[model samples]
Target: MAIYLVGDIQGCYDSLCVLLDMAAFNPQHDHLYVTGDLVARGPDSLATLRFMQELGEHGHTVLGNHDLHLLAVAKGIMRPKARDKIRAILDAPDREKLLQWLRHQPLLIHNETKNETASGFVITHAGIPPHWTVREAKQSARDVEAILHSDRYLWLLQNMYSDEPSMWSSSLEGIEYYRYTINAFTRMRFLTMSGNLDMACKLSPDKMSDENLVPWFAAKRRETIKETIIFGHWAALGGIFQNNFLGLDTGCVWGGSLTMVRWEDGQKFNLSCPV
Candidate 1:
């Protein structure tokens, strides 16, 4: 069975279906792993949520920033923005089920299969921070996931909105630790020269005017990482294919192409989308 990794659907259900058909994905055999942002900014979020939910174990996803936002809105911690385009999901009768599934999703997924290459891959919403090794990132993700899946999840959803504590520290505690972990896994894009998250900039590296800021992937990474890092969330990246990192968000909802990569062979499939 083939394993496929697709970029953010962002509620572009039609485009996602067409792209998956082109890939000849078989839910019975082939598994589909999403880079997250399963809903938002496009049409038919309800349908997208339903389709992915029905895929059951065959479809796996890590939580994206938008996904978290939806949960927050469901909990009345936040209001839905017009551009978010998620009202249908919030209004659906199965809203609780969909939100529960999304709420329980992890922030990181490590797929290091023994049958494949020794070093498999790790998928997160954006990318892993350079400060943490893969093991540290995984553990940090579990910490937040535990909260998200527990009674304190409402507290987390209520308090996870800050951009502070931009730098990571082992001594970080309480909300700082949870917020930092969430930001690093989902919202990270650029890092200041001092290796702190630059939460404001979303421009591609070439168009970046700040010379002091580097794309997270361009920063010096921890030397212990051996597995490939796969991520989405930066539509401006277009699609980055480097030595050990792959970015698949091609901005399908913004008139770019929906993109997916076959994990076993690294073959890519794309479908052009309209604005």
Candidate 2:
């Protein structure tokens, strides 16, 4: 079966469908995996969420920062942003079921098989820290996933925002814990040249300095996973990157093209957003 790893959809539903058709995906046989951020920023978030929910059974996805925020705001756990365009999903007749599936999505997906290209794919929404062993990273993710999918998930989502450590830690608590985990899984872009999270840097390459910040995938310990890691959430960084990590976010909301990667050969493709 062909496995296609895609970038952040970001509510670009039509674009995603276009890419899927281009790939000629066979849902009954082939597989598709996404890097998350399935909703928000662009139009058609409701359609995007519903589509992903239908595929989540056969596809793999890690919860993106925006995806979590959608859940938070929907449940009144967090207030909706001024510019968010998620009302369709929130008011939908199937909103509860769709959001529940999204919230239950995992934070990481590792190809458990032993093959080279076909197996050993580690997919996440953002990127895991350089210090975390593969086992540790997966375990930490499991911890967060449990809460995100649990009966008390709304409680955690209600209080899930902070900027405490800005790095990985085995012992973190409260908002700090959820915050760091979320950042690592979503907002991570650059790391200090000396190997630390650089949370303040968000420029699109040109404005970044070589003194302290490096893209997380370029940092040390990226090879610890020993496989391909496909992810999105880094529109500024754009498509493809260091090691086996494939970045699929093409910033379709920012007037960029929507993108997807075919794992059978790691081929990338883009579809323009309809204006």
Candidate 3:
């Protein structure tokens, strides 16, 4: 049984199907680890959610920022934007089931195996913060996941839309703590030299003029630097493969290609999006 880690699908179901076909994916045999952003921005979100839900145990996805936004919109905490394209999912007959499935998804997936020279990997929608170690990140994610799956989730979703507390601190508590953890796992991209999140800069490294803002993975003395992190959300980076960081968002919804990485051998597969 193979495990394929795929980039953000957004709502591009056709590209997802084509990429799976190219990979010869067998739902019954192979496992799919999705980098999240499963529904939004593209067409066919309902179909995409249905397909992923049907995959059951064979498929897993980390919750992305867009995915969280969907939950907020569904709960009337936020209004749907004109470009969201997720109305189909909210209006679908199986909306409850789909949202339930999405809510149950974690913000972080850590699989540490003994095979292939102690191979282990962590998957998140955006990326883990430089301040938290791999184990710490996982624990923080669990803390928030509990709230998300609990009865108080509606309150959390309603209050999760702020960028305050832009830095990590162990002393943080309450909804602010959870919000920071969520941002780290779902919206993080770059960090200031002092290890504080630089939320405003979304441009790629080459395009950015600020030298103080470093990619989260490139921060000095990052505790999780040794851990292999697989993440999406930075489509501008376009499938960056570094020593320990694997970026899989290739902008399929923006006329790029859908990309996936076979976990066993680290072999990559791609299917170009239609023009």
lDDT of 1 by residue, 1-275 (tens): 98999999999999989998999999999999999999989998899999999999999999999999999999899999879999899889999999998899999999987445335899999999988898899999999999999999999999999999999999999999999999999999999999999999999999989999999998997665778899999999999998889999999999999999998888999999998
Task: Estimate the TM-score of every prediction.
Answer: 0.98, 0.92, 0.97
Candidate 2 residue 212 C-alpha distance from true site, Å: 1.8
lDDT of 2 by residue, 1-275 (tens): 77887888888888888889998987777788889988888898999887767774567778898998998888787877887899898889998899778887888888766555465778888887787767877887888888877897877786667655776666777667776777787778888766656777776666676667777877778456777777888888767765677778878877888887777676777787754
Q: Please, what are the lDDT tens digits per residue for candidate 3 over residues 34-85?
A: 9999988888888988999999999999999999999999989999987889
In candidate 3, the residue pairs with backbone N, CA or C atoms under 3 Å apart (3 or more residues apart, or in different chains) clash, namely none
Worst 10 residues of 3 by lDDT: 218-227
Best by TM-score: 1
Clashes of each: 0, 1, 0
Candidate 1: worst-modelled 10 consecutive residues by lDDT: 112-121
For model 2, name the residue pairs that clash.
193-212
Residue ranges of candidate 1 with Cα displaced over 4 Å: 114-118
Q: How close is candidate 2 to the true structure, as a TM-score?
A: 0.92
lDDT of each: 0.93, 0.79, 0.90
Q: Which of 1 and 2 is the better model by TM-score?
A: 1
